[model samples]
Target: MDYRKIREAIIEETSRTHVHLVEVLGDTITTRLLKDFPEVSQVKLRISKPAAFSDCDAVGIEFLVHR
Candidate 1:
């Protein structure tokens, strides 16, 4: 697999996405990855927002996808 190409694809999708929810962003990224890279059987993604609360270090959502 071309790691550079994969990274570029992810970056492209992220830059173009304009979503209000983290879940939707994650889904968009996962969908792009699966579509662009057929060899990728699974995807593990974490979307985090640091300093989201004074009491916590960060808040985020993680998801695993299988193709």
Candidate 2:
């Protein structure tokens, strides 16, 4: 996603283009949240910033499986 400007300009030039790190953190947090609260089965996360007219930082991801 670092060089995602080749296709979608909006995704590369938006104030909320943090799906990368957002989802990663989402998965992590989701795992923890699930552990603490088993009632919730779904989690969605989003992170955004202001950088280069769009704003974004490196993103990492992780997911957890509940059994």
User: In terms of TM-score, which candidate is strongest?
Assistant: 1
Residue 52, model 2: lDDT of: 30
State model 1's lDDT: 0.91
Model 2 alpha-carbon drift over 4 Å, by segment: 1-23, 52-67
lDDT by residue (5-24, candidate 1, tens digit) is 98898788779857788888
TM-score of each: 0.89, 0.36
Indicate which candidate wins on lDDT: 1
- Ten-residue region with minimum lDDT total, candidate 2: 1-10
Model 2 score (lDDT) = 0.45
Ten-residue region with minimum lDDT total, candidate 1: 13-22
Clashes (N, CA, C under 3 Å) per candidate: 0, 1
lDDT values of the candidates? 0.91, 0.45
